[model samples]
Target: MLRARVELRELARDWRSWCKAIAEAAEKTLGSSRVYVFGSAAEGYATGGSDVDVLVVAGRLPRSFRLRGEIKARIEEEAGLPLYHPFEIHLATWKEAEANPIYREAIEKGKIINAQGLDSMKPIGESFGESRGRLPDRSLGQR
Candidate 1:
C-alpha cells in the first residue's frame, strides 16, 4: 500500500508538469489562447489514475466540433505531449466559455497556467495533498 501511494504521488506530479507544459506550448502556438487546469489536478486531489482536466480558451474557434478537436490535437502535438498523456482537454472560445455555465464555473475555480510563465504561477504539484518539500524539477513529462 505504501509503495502504491508513492507511485501515485509521482504520477500526480508528472500529470501536473505535463499540464503546465501543454499550457506553455499552447500560449506559444496560439497567441490569443489562454489555458486553465481544473478538476482533480488543479484542486490537489489527483491520484495516479486521475486525468488532468484542461480548458483552452481561445479568441476564436471553428464552429465544427471535429475541427476544434483537430486544433486541440495540434496543440498537444506542439506541446510534445506523449500519445498517452493523461489529459482531458476542452476547447472553447472566450465567448463560448462565458456563455456556458459549466465552463464559467471551471474558469472561476481552475488554475490559469498560460497567463504568464510557470515561474509566476504557484507550484501545482507542491500542493498535491501533502507538502513534498521543494517541487520536482520543471521537466516536461514523465521520466
Candidate 2:
C-alpha cells in the first residue's frame, strides 16, 4: 500500500512537470503569443488522466510547420513520459482571437499561465451574476 501511494505521488509530480515543460517549450518556440491552460487542469479539477490543453493566439504558423504535432513530440521526448495524449491546440491570430466571443469567454474563464501579448496571466474569477445582472436563486424556491 505504501509503495502504491509513493508511485501515485511520483506519477502526479511527473505529470505536472510535463505540463510545465510543455508550456515552456511552446512559449519558446511559438513566440509572442498568449498561452493558456484551460479545461480540467485550468479549473483545478484535473485527475490522473487529464491532457494538457493549450491555446495559442498570435500570428499564424508558417505552412511548413506542424506546430501542434511538433510540440507534442518535443514534450513527449523531453519529459520521458507519455502524459500528453491527443491534446487540443486552438491557433488563431491575435486579432481573430480578440474578435471571437468564445475566445473572449475563454479568456474570461481560462487560466493564463503565460499571457504574452495580453496584460496579465491572472485568472478572471468574476461570477456571471456579478458581470451581468443578478441571477435568480434556484435553490431558494424563487425564480
Q: Of the candidates shown, which would achieve the greatest lDDT relative to the real structure?
A: 1
lDDT scores for all predictions? 0.67, 0.53
Model 2, range 43-105, lDDT digits (tens) per residue? Answer: 777776455566665565644458656754664565354442434556655555568776655
Query: What is the C-alpha local distance difference test score of candidate 1?
Result: 0.67
lDDT of 1 by residue, 1-143 (tens): 78665655565577656776788777776666667788887778887778778888877678998898788888889877765556788988767877887666666666667534555344334333323332223242211
* lDDT score for residue 57 of model 1: 80
- Span of 10 residues, lowest total lDDT, candidate 1: 134-143
Model 2 TM-score, all chains together: 0.52
- In every candidate, how many clashes are there? 0, 0
Q: What TM-score should be assigned to candidate 1? A: 0.71
Segments in model 2 whose C-alpha atoms lie over 4 Å from true places: 1-16, 63-87, 99-102, 115-121, 124-143
